[model samples]
Target: MAGRKKTFHGVSVGILMVKTGFRRLPGDVGHAGTWDFPVQYRVVEGATPDKMMALESSGLLDEFKAAALDLVAGGVDGIATTCGFLALYQRELTAACGVPVASSSLLQVPLAHRLIAPDKRVGILTFSRESLHASHLEAVGVAADTPVEGMPADSVFVTAIKSGDTVPRFEAMRAEVLQAAERLLGSHPDVGAIVSECANMTPFSADIAERFGIPVFDGVSLINWFQAGLRPRRYPQA
Candidate 1:
């Protein structure tokens, strides 16, 4: 009746996290309060924000693969990561672990493109424009010329997040995010949707949408959607 013996576990998703001590707000993928389903997390010891944002993430591939494998061993049906830049490692991670891997919110770009008209494209709001290279986008099947906007390097959000502050200036961060969103939209008038590439920006997604009147997608929505497919709702038969 079955292939290899498989076990059922409570958790539906295993989140591979970067090694950082930052305070995760309610909307962050790393924050437990962000999910409606049971989930597990494993931090790749040396995969800090700096390392993750680096131009090349291949060096940390083995570390991330090991952590993801451990999560699979723990019985998680699917795996995800807390950073969008990990999009570059998507192929390797998925290959190393025999499970569905949703490594980056940027993966939503191609889907978002279908939701809007061809003339209107999806815009990306990332933590660092310089770091979100063509390889990252290409790895996830997104176009290299996709519109992208990055948080100001000196902004409060970037400063707090990179510093790993347990108690970040939320208001300051919100302002910074809103400002970034505005700048992105202003520069790219043809953008029909905004995709937040930073996992921590999920908390502000609602506000961004409300203010801009456009759908805003992030890691939270991506992973939640991915998990819903893995563990679908059971309805009563009519």
Candidate 2:
């Protein structure tokens, strides 16, 4: 038999990172060590967290689409983004880059709902409720009226990430996220699962799941799944 031709693809997933100076802890999407597979990263210039939270990320679609194309050109098998708010640009990015684009964790909402009982629905914990518009949810196939809770505007997580500050106190950020999760559960008692809409919130996903005894999904988990499709597992022959 002829030898298989060698391929030089370096990574399976390419991340479209937001242009921010905030500290990304180990589990955060922006942190390279968060993934088990080699992944590429390209920051979308001017796509700041604050601007995105304010629904201004639409202005940076061209920049993100261009970055996705760059990653595709570099041989990445799939693409994802660091901010869930980018759900608004998923279709455009997928069309432009000609690759599977998992632009936001919000994409898990529909699947989460399907995984749970009919009476129980998926709830979202995000960085900004006011900023998580119906358009963003609808674009990602989430219900327009889905229950959502947001981190406190004055939270350490919000302040640090939004301002691009490099000092995010992990403990405080976790506490704030827990508060948001609790609030989400309190207000939406039928929520059987949680989906965090801020990619940085992935660091506390396990904590949220343990505390609430419910499934928690986030950008990191979604990205990992997406990468698996890009490079599916192969079993060794016996």
Candidate 3:
């Protein structure tokens, strides 16, 4: 790649993955669009951040930090963590990686807010209200009071992510998400967009858009845009 002329973007992206099971791979995000930039990823030790924190409840994470630096070593211009819940470690993880790191798609909050009108606001879709913290919004540059709604299940998309040969209870899951989204928009009435807080929820974006008639953002889309900005195309030779 070094010897090749800059026929495309000279920059690349890196991802530090949470230790979710095989069901949570990131193939879906890449399909949203051509990344143009090279991508490198590595998994840390944990089934998921939800379970990882539950397992240890510790504030320090030395192992995940090492994993983050390893991916950056591949020449990626920036980095993003795989799970939104990892926002708890945003400052620490970003500091450890020594690069631009997205601790969460929640960052969309501030960006989306700017895109939205003053009268129309932005909303979020995640696992549960209890899981979110003021720092999560602050990390993303949105107010913690910003409207956020999601599945009643404590596990949220993680359930579907971990779905098996049984195909998951998507029908029921879809109903719940749809209801939550609809209720949120209906109640807020002035929401300009909805951000899917879970990466696994990308497949349902079209449905959300069609049902709600508003812009719907998901982690896959968020990461794609974030990665693009950090490693934009420099296809001078294209």
Candidate 4:
């Protein structure tokens, strides 16, 4: 009923996958010396349109791919790029990784669609205007018409992006993002679940849900599931 399987020890298995995303983030964009604290969100600080389009430091994308590959070589099952803005590079990275890379966390789009009825839509909270486009929608398996929203420049999050610092009032940032979500859901006539477009937004997931009374998803949790699905195992001794 299916293709032949690859077996390690006695167990047949699926391919390992890794996510590859843009790496424009600089050392200063981080907080507490760890990209671990909503690491991807700090991306906005460095990955501006000017920086992204610059030909000189264009190697940022390549750097991320290299990092992803190294991570995979070590034992990561699959890869998923943290930045949704990399939709244009999705196809390229998926091929380069030679594994079941999800390309972007937007893989949850179809899942979110299934989780709700046919007419509902999902709101995506992204870093900047670069995230909204037909190509990005297509890459995530969502319709071009799917309701989407961006983290507006006026918000504290956008301020964080530009200043590379957390706002004195994170509550304001959360409110702005949720405000965008509210507009999308209320106007679209079809928003079901909410998906965070940035890694930093993960910290706001539960907050968004509690405020909006709707499902909110971020790349980290979904990445874990994607990794879990393709995780490698140690074969038993014969």
User: What's each prediction's clash count?
Assistant: 0, 0, 0, 11
Q: Give the per-residue lDDT digits (tens) of candidate 4, residues 144-229.
A: 76667777766766665555453354566667867777777777756778877665566567777898788887765565566456
Off by over 4 Å in 4: 1-61, 166-169, 232-238
For all candidates in order, the CA lDDT equals: 0.89, 0.87, 0.66, 0.57
Return the TM-score for candidate 2, rounded to 2 decimals. Answer: 0.94
Candidate 1 vs candidate 4: which has greater TM-score? 1
- Candidate 1 segments whose C-alpha is farther than 4 A from its true place: 1-8, 55-58
How many clashing residue pairs, candidate 3?
Answer: 0
RMSD of 1: 1.8
Worst 10-residue lDDT window for candidate 4 reads 11-20
For residues 16-85, could you state the per-residue lDDT of candidate 1 as single tens digits? Answer: 9888887888889999988898889898988888888883834899888899888887788889989999
Provide the lowest-lDDT 10-residue window in model 1. Answer: 1-10
Per-residue alpha-carbon lDDT of candidate 2 for residues 1-238, written as tens digits (9 for 90 to 100):
0232324365878899988987889899989988888888998887777678765535787888889888887777789988999999888888898768899999999999999999999999998998999999999899988999998888898888877777757999999899999999999999999999998999999999999899999998898889888788999999
Q: Whole-model lDDT, candidate 4?
A: 0.57
User: What's model 3's TM-score?
Assistant: 0.78
**What TM-score, computed on C-alpha atoms, does each candidate reach?**
0.95, 0.94, 0.78, 0.69
Q: After superposition, how far is residue 30 of candidate 1 from its true place, in Å?
A: 0.6
